[model samples]
Structures are given as C-alpha cells and as structure tokens.
Target: STGTMSAEELMKRGKRHLSVALKEECVNKNHVNLNIVLDHLLSKNKEIDDAETLEWCKSIIAGDKTYKEFLEIVKSYNNSSICGLVWTAEYVAYRCRTCGLSPCMSLCMDCFKAADHDGHDFNMFKSQAGGACDCGDESVMDAKGFCPKHSKNKDRSKIEPPKDLLFVAEIMIPRLVVRLVQYLRHSGAEKQYISKMTSFISFLQELSETGDLMQQIFSNVFTSQNDYTTYMISKSDVGVEYDIYEASLKFDTINVNKYFPELADDLIHKTLLDEMFFWVIKSKFPEHLVTFLLSILPNEQYKLAFVEVFVEHYRCMMVELTHSEDKSSVSNSVVHISVQLLSPLKLAIEIVTKFHLIHIMFACLKHIINQARYGNTLNLTSNVMKEHCYWPIVTDFINILAHPPIVQYFLNSTSLVNAWADVISSLQGLNMNRREHDLHVEFETETYYKAFSAELEICSTPLWALLKHLNDSSSKQLTINIVNILVTYLNKWFTENSVGEIEMNPDEMSFHYPLHRYLSLLISNALQQQGMELTDLLPSLEFLEILYLHPLHLLVREFFFFFVFPFNFVVGTYKICYV
Candidate 1:
C-alpha cells in the first residue's frame, strides 16, 4: 500500500503524525517547541531532510492551522512570554561576587564579568532574560592585564603639573557655551556666567604652554552679546550687525542639561560637542570656528582626531537610519544631517587643501563620496544630492579644484588624482554584475546608472564652467593655472609607466572630456589669430611637446594625431620660418 505513495505524499503523512505527537507530548509543557518538535519529527522519519525540517518550522512560525491549535492546548500560553525563551534560552548566569556566601553563590546571575573588573561582595545576582554564561573579572582572562591604576587619594601638592592644559580647556568651552546660553536674555546671569568662564579660561591660559592656541579656540565662544535680540528684531531691522555668533548661541534652557551636564562627563561632552558641531554649521556661524578648532590642534594627529570625530558622527547617524523602520523620520533625519554637514565639510576641504594636508583631505572626501554612492536607506544619496543646497557644497569643492595653488599641488603628485579617481572607480564596482555574480549584491543596473549619471554631472559641472570662462581677457592667470593643470594630467597619461589604452573613443564625443573639449577649447582660444601670440602659447606647447616626445601612452599619441597634429602642421611651418 505504501509503494504507490510519492515523496510529497510521504511528507504530508509525516507532518500529520508529527502534529498528533506534538498535541500528545508538548501540551502543558513550556520548552523549546521548535527544537523539540524538530526532534520528534525526525525520531522515526530518517528520510526527512534538513530542508524539509526548515520548511516545516517556517510554516509553524507563520501560524499554521495545526500550530495554532497546539498553542491553544498549552497552559497559560502567551506568545511573547514563550517566544523569548524559545528563540534565545532561559536562565542567564554571571560570576558570583562571594565565593562561598551561599551554595548558589558561584551560580548567581547578573554580575559584571569583564576580565579586569575588580571583585566585590554581593548577595542575589541580577536576572537576565536568556541563557548567557559569565566568567570571572576580565583580569582573569587578559594576560597583559589592563590600564594602570592611579591612586585616587594621591595628593596633588607633591605631583608636578602636566604641561598640556588643552584637554581641561576643551571641556570648559562647551560647558561655558551652555552656561552662557542658559542665561541668554538675562544680562545679569549671562554676565556672571561669562565672568566665571573667563576666569577659568584665564587659569587654563596660565597653565598652558600653548596659551595662544587656547585663546584662539575660545575667541568666539568668549564673545558675549544678546542672542535673544535677533528674535526680538523685526525683518525690517536691516544694516544692523546682529551678532550672528551670539544668534547661534541660542539653546533650550530646559533641555540643554540633557546635552551638557554641569558636572564633568566625557560622554556628555562628546554628545554635546557632536550636536554643537552640526549646530554651528546649520546656524551659519563663521567657518573660522571650524578652522580655529582644527588649527588649534595643528599637528596631523589632532587634525585627524577631529576628522575621525566628524566621520564617526556621520557614520553613526547613517547606521541609525539603516536599522530604523520609521520611513518618514529616516528621510527627515538624513536630510537634516546631510545639509548640516555640507558647509562644514566644504570648509574642511578648503582648509586641508590650504595646509597641503593631502592624505587627510583624501580620506575625508573618500568617506563622503563612498557613503553618497552606495547609500540605500530611504534613497538617502539621491535625495541629499538632489537638494538645491547640496550643489553649493559641491561647487565650493569645485572652486577649490579651480584654485591655482590647490591645482598645482594636486598636479605635482599623482596620489591625489589617483585617490579621487579611485573614489569614482568604486561606483563602477557597484555596476559589475556582468563581470561577477553575487547573490547578495543590492546594487542593480538602475542603481548604477543613477549613481554614474550623478557622479559624471558633479565631476563635470565646475570643470565645464571654468573652461567656458577661460577665453576672457582678464582670465590670463586663471588660464595659465588651467593650462598647468591640464598639462599635468595629460603628461601622466603619456608617461611610460601609464597603461596605454584609448580611454575615450574618437567617435563618441558626448562621453569624452577632461581631454577632448578642454583641449579643443584651449587650443582654439590660443590660436595666433585669436590674440594669443605664439609666445603666449609657447609654455603650453612646450609642455605638450614634452608629452609628445615620450610617445608611450596610446591616448596621448592618438590625441597628438587627432587634435595637436593639425595645429602643429599649420602653425609650426610659419613659426619655424620665423625662428
């Protein structure tokens, strides 16, 4: 009779038998139902594979007809109460503080169990929801031990004072800002707070070897004026210097403590500083504040510390959006964070470029571009870049690229250009389904297209605008800078080390740039009849001649053949005769 049955029919028969077994044995029992049921199903059914078991478990969790009926038979069965124990486990245990206080001491739950944690005497241990085991203090496990313990009761009178007071002073800045804002409208209270802050600042200045740096850091925060006055003044209040620094000082008196507490707390400082960092940018406080903070710490280590803080804060906000289920809040929060970051980041790029801190700048830009390229939460990248305000930030960065000093610095080193190109190349990997198959790849062709189009537009906009204005008479120096930048880029391609493939096709004019349109325009505008004498063009021509002399990269050779060949043919004949 069983010989006629198919595999599917056998599975159904097995499931029926398993349901009856669960009803008879699992009723009135509060245990791991899934695992227990899985065991019972396989007790005699050796033919039931792991895949079949998983399918059955999924069906039960989805509230199958038989599973619901089984649940009804269990005594005092609340799904939540049992689901926790079922999914995780029961009875979490931690180390016992007392070795032999009671028989259950060693087995007691809820003690802190870090390897280096100091021991303590205690009674009943705390209870947690699930099965987790704890060993003794962390020192029991850490072979190298932990941080050095300083005596809490040591007298300060005998100890020499530390040379650097910046750490203490940095904490004071935010605390004082909070104090000043707390008493904003009340002049008497505000004055008193300012006096106290100034006194503390003076003492720190006395202690600091780098007193000038401390003074620079606190310069704006120490400047007190009526912050509330801006709100009082009407729109018609024009031509008045409203003390925008003070205007940005406005803070919620009641909730301000939540951000910055009166007592010293590193956590509160970190939280408040992060909020304040974003606030300064959003409120349009001068960029000098960021510059000052960065410059105060001037060394690479400190600048990197500040950059790490900015990046970590950004990453945290984005991670929160990734895990969140609330769609509307995610969108609003992302937009808020993105807009706040734009100005400060632009200012950061400018500052880093000015200081010739290429590595730090590259790191910062890489983080920004990567996040914006691959961000999937609520379509954050697309939304943020699409905003009108976002472009000004991009334009500011583009302006930096147009600046002669920055361009010269970048051109002298291929590392910066390569770093920038690497960021753009990361987008290409997102589109590489045709090259490699990944089951988990979230980026599809459409996503790649959108990102590619946006990236191209952003990278091209400023270059195009700058190139279009190069023909003006007053733009000679700008033209020289542009020429230097172009020549450097072209020179790299023509170098023997460069891979010598044609990157741009001769026919597809639309996709060609940074070489095609820029070169054509530079040469067209500099022609002998166009008022640029042969002398004026000699430097650019000489640079190109150098590129032509190397003769390795196919793009450079093709470029000479296609564009420069004709120009040289017409002009070199007459120019040679004059020579």
Candidate 2:
C-alpha cells in the first residue's frame, strides 16, 4: 500500500483524473494543460520527496483553487498547437520513519534501483498504518529504530536520567496510569476522578510543594504507589492486578535539561535534605516527574531547594573552607564504599537542569580534585583511573548538555571549554550555520579550536591520572569506560548533523573542528592506551557501523547495562585475580 507503489502508478492515477482536462484543452485554443497537470500531480502526491517535482506540483497548486480550475488550464493547453502540455518532475523530501533519512522519493525506475527499494515507510507518516508507534519502537536507523543520529547516543544517556525515568520506572507509571484511569472510569472512584484532587495529583511532581504536612502525605503515597507498581510489574501480572486489584491514575523528550529550572536554593534550609536526597538518589525518577518539576521550576521556588541541596552536599563532600570534615576524606570514602552513590542524585539533578546544580557540583569537583592530592591514592600497576571516582567525572558530560538549547548556548558563548573541552567542542554549533554568527565569531572559533586540541591531548595521555594511583593493578572496567567516552564522542560528532560532521572532519583545513572525532579516531587507533586487548570494547569502526542504523537502538540498553552492571563484575574479577 505504501512503498510498493511506483511513480508511474501515481502518474497513471493522476493522469486518469487529468483526462477530463485533456479533452477540454483539445476543444479550446487557450493553453493551460501544464498548470492543470501540476495541480493533479500535487493533489495525488503530497509526501513525495522529488524536489523538482514537488516545486512544480506546488506551483500548480498555487495556481488553482480546485480541480475544476486546474482542469480548465489543462483543457486550454491542448487547443494551443505548440504549447508544452505534458511535463514530469520528481518531488524530493520524503524521509524514512526508521532512519529519518530521505533517500530519493522519485520514480527513477531504470538507473537508481536502490531508490525503489523499501527505503521509506510511508506508513509511519500516515494515520491508519502507523497505528500507535510507541517509545519502544526504536527502528528508524540501521540497527536501531532511533534515528542514525541517535544510534550512537550513549552520551545522551549520561544526562543522568531523571529520577522517575520512564525507562527505569517503566512498569510502574503506565500501570498506575492505567489503573488510575480505569478506577476513575468505574463505579465508585468516578467522583474522585472528576475531583480537583485527582487533577492536581495527576500532575504531582515534587510533593515538596504541597506544604510540609501534605508533602509528607504525598511522599508516602508516591513511594507506596510507585513501589506497588514496581512489584506488580516485576511479577508479570501487572495488568490484571491494576485492573481488578487496585485503583489509581497517572501519566507523563527533548534536550529537556536546558530549559528545566533549578530547584529552590533553600532546599537545604527548608526541607529535610536527607529525606529528599534519598528519594532522588534511591531510584531513577519517572519522566513525568522530571518534566513536571522542570515545567514548574522555571517559575517556582522549588528549584532553590534543589540547588541548595546540591551545593550543601558538595560542600560536605569537598568544600575545604566550610567548617566541615576534610573534603578529601569523603572523596576517598566515596571511592572505597563499593557502591554507586553519586549517580542517582546526579541523575535527578541532571533531569531538572543540565547546568542546574552543575556550577555547584563542578565547584565541588574542583575542590575534590584539589583535595585528591592529600588522599591515599591507590596503588596501580599499568591501569590508571581504576578507582570509582574517576568514572563519574569522565562519563556524564553528555547528560550535562543533552538539551540542545544549552548546546546552542555553548556554541554561542565565547567562553572556552575549561574542563570537559572535548565534550563542549564536539556538540557546539551543531546544525547552526543558519543562526546569525556573533560578533565574537572569531574568538569563539579560536577558543573552540584550542579546547578541541586540549581534548585531543587528554585522549592521548593522562586518561588514567587517578587510576594510575591504584599502583599498577589493572582494571578492564576503567579501561573500557575511558574508551567508551571517546567512542561516544566520535559517534555524536560524526552522526549529529551535517554541520557537526563537517566541523568534525579531521581532514578539515580549518583550525576549528569538532572535539570528539579526533579523540575517537585517536582513541580507536591507540587502543593500547586504554590497555584493552582487541576484544575488550568493540572497535570504534564497528561501534560506528552499528551506531546509526536499524535495530541497534536496543544497543542503548546494552550500553547502559555495560555502564551499570559491568563495572561491578569487572572490578570483582580484577580484584579476585589480584588476590
């Protein structure tokens, strides 16, 4: 019904409608067939990607208000002896659902045979055939359903993920929403569903805003509901249980982090930091919560709470000037705890704003890095950065800038990439040649090149500055992480957009370039630097190969799995071998 049809088939149908015009044009001396043909072509082919044909069709559509008006033009053309009556052109701009790539939508039957293949899914753009394309449908690119740009979106995942993550709390929210909706629709709960309470909780984001007493009530209810949903789904009878067992209601993209507002700075003074921090850190939050909180925060006082907590925690962890415990001691303890502590809270903060608590956290990082000199740096053999602290600092840059607006800011700012130079330069100026270049363009480009070069330097050496402190005890895990960051940087740069690809072109004669391509190519080339044997992490080219095609968006799950679970196993094995 879709790609199965040919351009000629389309023309035939269009021509069938045009035959009426042909007769009229033959009867008259006026010339109008060209306009009529274009009108018929556009009416029959709206999604066609043939650029030339699309323009001609548009021209015809523009010339006529109805089929009758177009028909009059076509009829007049036949009467004129020397007029060009029949003309054919191809439209260009049809794109694939799976890949977002618009290959060619023309009817080039003879030469480009590949264009006739199942390159586009006309069904996706249509209503009946598309049915209900859900989030799980990740088949746009080659290996994954995500776009080729997203196929290699490992860096995107680093955006820590909001606390109530859809992916993480998947079983919970949908079930709750389904249960709540069902219960509301049924006999007794219908009134409650229609009530304002239901309307309010439906958008229940941070319970903290409901006042202290209500906050306490909501905190318990929220946890209980999510936990119930979690247990229900984990057991596999979630549907029956939610439908018959209990009643409730609920529901909930983008470079979302940038626009999201920060939590109120008073979070430390007003709320129980310990209580709130745990929930934020205890589980990956649902996307609805992330979005709601983000939506509310731009104007509310809650963001102050978020910022305060982050600042205080980091102060507790690393601020030497504060009348607190030695910052380095905590940093050392976090490494030795054998638990992933920072990630969950970091995830929550990231969901709210990419740079929300960033300045605070980064200030803390600087303090921690400064204090690391005083800590009992671990012994190392060959591998450096084998400790826990190394991974968090290096891995989450993408999550830090997942929202494009922030990225646009980076590209706009003349400020140099002082810390994660490679990361900053890689995403800057992506798809933005159209935006007016700033007066500081020369400065921005120069600083961008410097940061890009610096990132390349980091890729080449000092990768395991902290890991090396482990005293030559090798870590396959840490090695993989280091390599993993580099690989992802390459993927984003190479596949992000045409401008990024151009900026990332390692061969460019221009001084300014995307940061990560050089890093990825060098990292791939110098695998020996990470101490990974040929088989450890996949080669960069292979990651690149499967990065942007169909079915591999599922690989994103694998990538996260590698991030979350592999470290434990890899670390366990490495430690055991040494023992």
Residues 306-393 of candidate 2: C-alpha lDDT, one tens digit per residue:
4444434433332221212232333323221111112223333443344343444343434333333322221211112112233333
Tens-digit lDDT track for model 1 on 1-579? 223333344345556554343333334342233334443433322322245544454233223235333223221121110000100123344434343221121222222332233454533434322122212212121211211221122232333223222332343343344332322222222223333334323322232223233434344333222322222233243222225434433422112122223312121113323334443333232222232333222222333344534443332333333333443343343332222222233334445453333343344344444445653221224444333222333433454454444544554455555554443333322332222222444555554455455545555564554454454555555455545555555555445323233333222211222343354466566562245654664456655554443322234334443454554553454345334
Q: Report per-prediction Cα RMSD to one decimal.
A: 31.1, 28.9
Candidate 2, overall lDDT?
Answer: 0.31
**What C-alpha lDDT values do all the predictions have?**
0.36, 0.31
Kindly give the stretch of ten consecutive residues in candidate 1 with the minimal lDDT sum: 78-87
Pairs of colliding residues, candidate 1: 114-137, 114-138, 115-137, 115-138, 115-139, 116-138, 116-139
Question: Model 1, stretches more than 4 Å misplaced?
Answer: 1-176, 179-275, 278-363, 367-393, 398-448, 491-517, 521-579
Q: What RMSD value applies to candidate 2?
A: 28.9
Best by lDDT: 1
Query: How far does residue 120 in candidate 2 sit from its true spot (Å)?
Result: 12
**Model 1: residue 233 alpha-carbon error in angstroms:** 36
Evaluated at residue 307, the lDDT of candidate 1 is 50
